[model samples]
Target: MKLSDKAYEKFKHHLMMGDLKPGQFISQRELATMTGVPLAPVREALLRLELEGVVQIAPQRGIQIVEVSLRFIRDTYQLRMMIEKEAAAKFAGNASEAMISQLREVHRSVIARVDEVGPSDNLLKDAQGIDDSLHDTIVSSLGNELVDWLYAMNNQRIQLIRLAHGHLTLITPGTFRQVMTEHMAIIEALESHDPDAAASAIEKHLTAALHRALGL
Candidate 1:
């Protein structure tokens, strides 16, 4: 990777890991040191971050990380719902039975494990992966690079928002199970090759998630 891209990735890693906080301000030199990259590369990274609304760079006041607000939560979830709902419809029309079956099985397995043994740290990790895979598969089904790029940018913001709200990673076992159940609903719609049902399921899941993020 180029130095600037490396810096950008490092910054994103720290942000998602909660090492870098939202609404915090740091100088370019400080960011460079934190990312272990040269100042020039860090500057380039900040420009990209600023354009993505991940950070704001002021002439004299240093860079400020995005602050999570109600509007931010709504906007992020709105974009996600818009993209994934369309993708889910497309995926339902084209996805193979075997792929849909595999998704259903994985979700069922996770829910069963949670029921039997309760949630472990490892199980939670597995649950997170299962949650991510379904959504990722749906979104990638669109096969549009520009849409993919936009989704990825918005996804970073979504992760930051989730981290701030303690929704996904810090979820309770019951809540995690509920999420898996929701995924099962989406998968079932896909399995049936019902595009409208799949899209509606995606919208319902995302709306619930948005509410959770908003603490409503």
Candidate 2:
């Protein structure tokens, strides 16, 4: 990757890991030193993050991480619900056997680890990978480049917001099991090639997740 891309990923990782927390003030000089990237590339990365609405750039005050408000949560979930519901239906109709098998294996691996010692960091990372792959595969099946790009951008922001709130890494036994169950439901719907059922399952999953995020 280019230097600027590397810088962007490094900065984004810090944000996602809560090192640079929501509403916290940071300087490009400090970030450049922290990420070990040059000032120019770091500045470009910061501008890109600003365009994504993930940070506020100020000449004098310093960059402030964007706060995750209830309204932001509401609007984000609303948009996700609309796109994912449709994506699920399309995936049910078009996904190949191999694709279905890949999702099934991910689900099985996650469920199998639930009986392990604990939800270790590796386990949580596995679960996160499953979540990302499943959703991206479904969305990509729609064959709309623009929608894919848009959803990816929105999803990245949501992920960072979750990370900022410490929700992204919540891997308690209960939460892990709940996530496995929900993913299994969607996988079942897709395997059966039932569009309506797939859509309904996705709706239910996203709705429940939104409620959890809102602490409802």
- Against the reference, the lDDT scores of all candidates come to 0.87, 0.83
Residue-level lDDT of model 2, residues 1-216, one tens digit each, is 888899899988877776888778888899889889999998898888888778899879898888788887788889888999999998999999898998999788777775766788788877877877788888889999989878977886687657755563344555788877888999999999999999999999888888878777
RMSD of each: 1.3, 2.4
Q: Candidate 2 versus the native: TM-score? A: 0.86
Which candidate leads in lDDT?
Answer: 1
Task: Score candidate 2 by lDDT.
Answer: 0.83
TM-score of each: 0.96, 0.86
Cα lDDT of candidate 1 equals 0.87
- lDDT tens digits, residues 147-167, model 1? 999999998888778778775
Regions of candidate 2 where Cα sits further than 4 Å from its true position: 1-3, 116-121, 167-169
- Candidate 1 least-lDDT 10 residues: 166-175
Question: Judged by TM-score, which candidate is best?
Answer: 1
